[model samples]
Target: MSNRPITPLLDKVCCPADLKGLSDDQLKQVAHELRQEVVSAVSETGGHLGAGLGVVELTVALHAVFDTPRDKLIWDVSHQCYPHKILTGRRDRIRTLRQEGGLSGFCKRSESEYDAFGAGHSSTSISAALGYAVARDLGTAPEAGVGDAIAVIGDGSLSAGMAYEALNHAGHLGKRLIVILNDNEMSIAPPVGAMSRYLNRLYAGAPFQEFKSIAKGAIRHLPEPFQEGAKRAKDLVKQVTVGGTLFEELGFSYVGPVDGHDLDQLLAILRTVKTRATGPMLIHAITKKGKGYAPAETAPDCGHGVSKFDVATGVQKKAPANAPSYTKVFAEALIREARADRKVVAVTAAMPDGTGLNLFAERFPERIFDVGIAEQHAVTFSAGLAAGGQKPFCAIYSTFLQRGYDQIVHDVAIQRLPVRFAIDRAGLVGADGATHAGAFDTSFLANLPGMVVMAAADEAELVHMVATAVAHDEGPIAFRYPRGEGVGVELPEKGVPLEIGKGRIIQEGKRVALLSFGTRLKEVREAAQALSAEGIEPTIADARFAKPLDEDLILGLAREHEALITIEEGAIGGFGSHVAQLLAERGVFDHGLRFRSMVLPDTFIDHASAEAMYAEARLNAADIEAKVRDVLSGATAQAARRA
Candidate 1:
């Protein structure tokens, strides 16, 4: 709190309406203060740093130019909404970003009325904004009406197919909508694909830029009668170059390649578009990611995602790791596999570094493919690679893999292609919140026929799972591992592939059984220790495969124990659901047995520490101990009655 920034101009701005009467110069000062404020806030609360810094001016300009709340303003991905949050009455809670019961890291509609639509996923803004535009038109009177629908989407987000689909639909509808293409030249990783190159060509000094400037400047000076002709001449000249003509063909009135940081330019263009444009309009504003701070500007990824850092030195304060992250373990293990088998290749959808495929790319440059924010394409491309006899490992985050489910089913699962899925962030990821949680991946993927699903219990287990995926060529196989460091277990020099559908018992005990899946094995072990303290001495087993339920092991456990409890990091329909189905099918439940399934709660858990989230979901070691105690207590009471 002592390190809080002194924001004089921004102090006056409690909301967007407060910026209404400020002069252009004062507004510029506000942008400067706002950028510093965002930097200070995010420095304390580690989150998306660069993206918010990149859009400070644009956020101020949009709020000043457009009537927000009434006029819907949607942010694509919404990682860049920090500055917008500051201006929209959430300033008080800005420092509480991504904490439990605090402000969310992304724009959440439930969090604020100013956030027109909630978005943690990318490329959905255009479609959502178009809906708002249509809704506005459908209203009978201005009193019940929406003013405007504006979507501020990044260039990286534009790489997704959904953005293009929305553009095509918006074009067809010809609704009154405004789409601001915030071309920052960087995403989580550097922007990829032909779309990024095309955008580069637009802003890159070509003959069109000089011509555009001269034509615009000359048009204002022209007599009233010649001004219309000169504007037509400018449009014809713009068409000569392949800059914004693609958007024009999409039925949008294309309006930029404008400087996003320039307040006067943004204000002028937005004011003109607000008053006159009838159909969909696209404002392509060029800006740098991590524009303000020198450290952020020079750093690779443009300091896209950062930990809590010192504002002065820009050095992040990261906790010392006890063990290698599951991501790194998977990457190193995959690299070892690839070295032995040249058929192994990697594919990522705009997240090479995040998925630890950057390590793979560094070693096997030619073997790695970055599909650039197109998960659907990445999945099918991996399927194609497998079909061509190459062992392709499609590395994607669990939450993001949801986007390519159709392709996963149609192209990979149906065809029975042996495309290995390396699912990172496979459970309740911290800070990013429920939208980014890998809660549903196991549930969704396990349901598909011929799909083999496995979860790693720790970093050591993750190494083996990677080896298992590499060894398996029967059909599509997936292995899920969570975010952050593993539980300090000594890793094998190299992973030895485990037999399919087999689980190992940690220890043999009595009465109750704890069937653990994924990273929750550590907690299960701790719970067992607590139970042992109480003289319960419960049996514990790690269920490695969710799809092929280690049938014999599960049945043996059910037959041996009076009460059985299954635990996993995923949602209810995941490992627990499969286990329950197996028990019911085997008629194990026909005998009087107390059973409990510990999984994530039905409601979405908000941003918090991993421990806090699991505690709230009642899947913590303490919760597990309590559940076991209750089950044992009930069993003992029933035995007394029978005796």
Candidate 2:
């Protein structure tokens, strides 16, 4: 280890402006130090480790070349931005990365001037950069000095249609934009699609140095007519063989298949492209995920994101109990269902492992589809599978599903296909923070006509819901579950489908009734227990289907109880909102019945432990108890005054 600490160098950088004064050598040194800092910081915080590590050199090269804060640098997905964050004045608070009230794990424009655009989802960089480029051309802010728009997108993100859409538009419009294709052969998983295959073929060819030298010499000696003819011939050859010809045809000047890890090669190529290339340019740089760490390199999953681990041993800290995660439960249930039915198939957007479909993939390789971070494609593709008489379970995180919202509405709901959506991470996702939070899926999906939306109250309920989704072939059905383990519920041999639009009463009581949905059942139970001790007995009902609204159960609860509270693990427009809307529509509130909605606060919550994040959002037992007490006290006061 180098004894010289990089603290001083890192401390001096408040933004990219400070980096402008540093020499190339210093920048190189800073890049190395930044990597070290990232490794060290993430060892404590535990976030998207591999991505940040992979982008160390790229981050250094970009800042060293572009006048950031003036020249826009939009990082695709933004997970690979720890090094960028370190160099851009946030070093002092780096340890607080992904923690509550601390620095965000991904790039945030509000955090600093250097973060030209905010991103959490993949494949949005090119579009964002194009918008910036257009704004510059239209003189959106003349005094802001928007010099250039650069988009750094991963090869995995290239599989998305949105990325291609942006590329097509950028090429046609002839905007002065730069797109750096970070070809790491992985995007949370191995890259997929025709583009990935083409890029691999390009990588297999001879080095760019040899090709460039040969082309330069051949072009220099030819006569004007022959030169033009040779240029046409060379372009024809490029079109026949080079994968980048597609980008070129799209109107971008294509460059490289360069070694991303080589500092000199990267800088040299970047400098050339920065000056020589006109209009839109695509610079393809090949890199390795988890590049520096030996354990991460050898890990089956590339150590994409890790829990708190020992630096020397790479062993994660063990939790006290051994419980299967919600994802595992869902996968196991799906596997059981699939084994029984030939029509069952699984799909994911480059997240087989994260969505718990790896077990299914291993067992039924032919039936599994890893669509590579293209959520829109995954949803529509599943709709196609459903149309073909195959039962498709599109397992995607709730946050990622936001990207495919339109497709879900247009392809699945409009046609009323029986696409089973196994919505994972259906609530506040810790560490990855606001961008990755599964907040809006419940709300968004619930509103779509003919959409069947349900939330698992526990792990066992998740199993049952999986069964329900598989059995229900009437239309698009979705079941959401939170991240992490189930509440140690006993495993069921197999799941049985439940009645549609029905709710079950968990505990019976009197004066007040609590309508709980999703994982909030535990908190509601806890609050009920505390209230029981206080002589305020409450009834509990698990409202399974958000869309169906369990009208009879809700209306009965409304009429029976003095106060009815609806709780869910989502944002404003989710389960709670739907319940309120349903009750209001039926004139349930016309009797002046007291009602309260427990939901995630309107503001974005930062990354932390799931429990800590929930508590901060005031969605925990204590918070629920407080709300119940407040509502009860108000009701009591009103009754006493009336008497």
Candidate 3:
């Protein structure tokens, strides 16, 4: 509160409408104030810092010129919507970012009308904006009154195939749409691919200070009232070509490579394009990620994402890690496998750093591939690698892997390719919320035939799973691990390949058997200890493989224990469902076995800490303990009825 900046110009602005009243100089002042507010707020409540900082001037200029909430302004993968959120009457709640019961880190349609299209994934903006433009043309929602549809996409987003698909379609449709290329030359990671290179050339060749064209003068020279006579027919087709660029080829009137931070240049270019654009138009604005903040600007990731930090020093106030993170563990295990086998290579779809493949890339640079933001290609490419007798480990985040599901099914599953899918962030991820949560991967992957699905109970288990994936050249195998640190378990010096489709018992006890999958075993163990206190002493068995079902272990648990409870960090149709199906088919339920599955609720959870999210999901230690007691009581009731 003490560090909050004085914003005389910005204080007057209540909404985007208020921005329209401010002079260009005052708007520039507002942008400066907005940047200060962003930096200050993020220092207390960390979130996407660099992206918001990058687009301060662009955000101000767009709101100042365009009629948003009416004219659909879509931000591609709207992580940078924090400043936009602040300007659109949400500054009061800015400090509560990424906290429980607070504002979401990403743009949400439910949160505000100004956020035209909600996005947590990248490269969907062009398609969404095009849909809005088409809807406006078709008079689909006349009463709502949608105007010029604008998509502000980053340079890295263009690397995805979806953006180009929309571009190709938009060119064909020839609608009055607008696309702003927010060319920061990076997206979370330093961008790669031909598209990134092409954009780089555009950025390098263009005069950074000026617009690509003198757009205002051209619009001025054209007469507003064209003749209705036979002579008017000659100029029917508007021969408007701002510049012969790539966007022009896509049927968009190309405008910039303009200085995004320069308010005068941004306002002028936006205003000129806003008036003159008939068909689809593109304005390329070059911006520096984390522009104002020196600490962020100089950093490797440009402070892409951060924890709460001191404003002066820019040092994060993170709690000391008790154990290595699951990501690091995964990277270390993967590196070990790669070292032992020349055929063992890694592939990541734009998330080398996020998936911990960056570490792998440092050692075996030639063997590692960072395919830029294209998960679909990454999956099929790995499948191809496997087909060529190479063990390609496709390291992707669980949520991101969903994008490549069709490829996984068609390319990997059908052929039974041994593409080791290292699914990172495999459970209820915090902050990024429901969109980024890896809830469905288990269900989706396990459903496929010949697919081996395994979840790591701890960092040590993760090592074995990596080894298992490498050794198993039979079919497609996947191993999932959660995002944060492990429970400080001592890791093995080298991983031993696990026996396929088998489970290991942790604690053999009496009345109830707790069948655990994934990282939830930690909570299960805690519940067992608490249950031991109550004289319950429930048995705990880690179900290492989800797909293959571990039939012998599962059936033994069902027959031996009075009650059996299955726990997993996945949704309904995953491990528990598979176990349920097995028991049902084998008539275990018919033999009076009291079975229950504890899973994430059939609802989309909002952003919170992983602990808070698990509480809401009702899959914590207490919840597990409660389920065991409840089931045991039910089993006793059944026994009394039999007597």
Candidate 4:
């Protein structure tokens, strides 16, 4: 408490209802205190700081003006929900963010009733808020008190096609919905695409200076009798602010590019919208990312995401780098490949930094594409590039890649377009939880015909896999690697492409075989070492390609070993399932062979450290050792009776 910022006003507020008691001036004070509290909490916990900081005033104004839980307030890509969470009675656990058993970094529906919709991925909020509006209009649950449905979406989130789809539909349906465009002009990476440019143009012109007056005096807010004043206001809007064109053309009554950090302006705008809004409306709020904090404002990415840092200096206390991250290894390997082949290009869906393609872009700016938050577009765009003869590596996080599945199947896989997918965060990612976990890409991608799926065992393997993806031109090929630092293996000076559809023998032994996939080979080796201490030298192999399933190696392992256990950092119907299908087809299972497939649990694992999550899934080193022992002990007892 000594180090904590004093928040006298914020302390009095337990929920949004408490905010309603405060005077408008008091609400401004609360916003000030709340920003400090958010910065202080995030400084201790190390989660998304700048986004939450930016929305401090918006969060306060929304809660102060509208009746929440009753009025569904949806946050698009709710990484900005930390301040919202603090105001909605989650402040005590605020410092526990992104930790095991702690609050989620994003808005979760189950976390609270105040969290109207769960949003991990961007551009879903408008759709959800529309659903709430329709449901309320139709009186689906009057007892639930579903009132005004408001979606607070960032301008960056607007880049996705879904937001516009929802906008178009809401306009056509003519439902009373509120879409607050929180335009900070930054979403993870700096904004991209036409939507970003259009938003900038909205703020750039002097026309915006007159938009607030016309917007505030618009017909919707006035009584039905003041019809002439409303018409005049509407005409004035058309004369200014791009003729109130795009959003107005879409059916939504477009509101101002208001000052988002101005508590008074936000309160005035929101109060008007809440009380008088009769149809779909879009409120454009201009706010600064890292609004109050000097460290975040000056830092690159505006401190989009940060490690636990000192409040005074803003210097992060990162662990000593023992090994380079897998992202770095992939970036360097891709750079090497790009150096060799000019056609080797990259595409990322608003995650150049997250996917390490920002590093790639530093060297090959012309070849790299940051397609904003539009994953579906990114996938098909890469397919177009591949069809045109350039070797396109569609680098995307495994979780986000789910958005582009239809494109992958229809455009890349079916067409045999030879598009390389550099799938990062390919396993249970820490902090972000089940919503952001890369747990299902293998199952999804491998199921597609002509799609080659491979997972790297270590950083060196990742280097080789990058080379392999660059070389593979037969069909669509993908290589997956998890988040964080590697196993400290020495990287090759240059990546040498590995033979396709082959598994490598790490160590050869007898009774039991441990077939590992992805970065779990590190754990498999540790388990093998522990087993060796007990006089059980297990056969260890790295199943490099999940889709291809090195048949010869798998068959040989089944023939030689008494028990075969397949391990992967993926869900069911992935690598282990493919191996099972192979063994069953070969009639290996008919010989009473002990087979077990280690996968992520059927349930969604919550936010935790990657190691802890793996342990919960029972795919950790100790868990592997136990599983091997359990399989062998049971097998040995049964064999003794047969002997």
TM-score of every model?
A: 0.96, 0.92, 0.95, 0.97
Q: lDDT tens digits, residues 355-454, model 4?
A: 9999999999999999999999999999999999999999999999999999999988999999999999989988989999999999998888888999
- The lDDT of model 4 is 0.89
Comparing 2 and 3 by lDDT, which wins? 3
User: Per-residue lDDT of 1-643 in model 3, one digit per residue for the tens?
Assistant: 5679998888888889999888998999999999999999999999899999999999999999999879889999999999999999899999999899999998888988898988999999999999999999899955979988999999999889999999999988989888999999879899999888777675454355433243333334334312222121123223322233677677665654567887877787677667766777777778989999999998899999999999899998999999999999999998998889999999998888898988999999999988899999999999999999999999999999999999999999999999999999999999989989999999999999999999999999999999999999999999999999999999999999999999999999998999999999999999999989989998999999998989999999999987899999999999999999999999999888888999889999999999999999999999998998888888788789989
Candidate 1 regions exceeding 4 Å error are: 140-144, 207-242
How much does each candidate deviate from the true structure in C-alpha RMSD?
Answer: 2.4, 3.5, 3.2, 2.1
Q: Evaluate model 2: give its lDDT.
A: 0.84
Model 1: pairs clashing at backbone N, Cα or C within 3 Å: none
Best by TM-score: 4
Judged by whole-model lDDT over C-alpha atoms, candidate 1 comes out at: 0.88
Minimal lDDT window, size 10, model 1: 221-230
Per-residue CA lDDT of model 2 for 1-643, tens digit only, reads: 3522456566666776776788777777777777778877877778788888888889888887888878899999998998998878788788888887789988998898888889988889999999999999899855877888999999999988889999999989988889999988888888778888888887566664554443343234323322242133235335324446688788876655666776766676666556655588787777878888777777876778887777777777767656789999999899999899989999999999899899999889999999887899899999999999999999999999988999999999999999999999999988888888988888899899999999999999999999998899999999999998888878788898999999999999987889999989998999999989999889999999898889999999999988999998898888888888888998989886789998888998877878898998889988888988888888899899989
The residue ranges of model 3 lying beyond 4 angstroms of the native Cα positions read 206-244
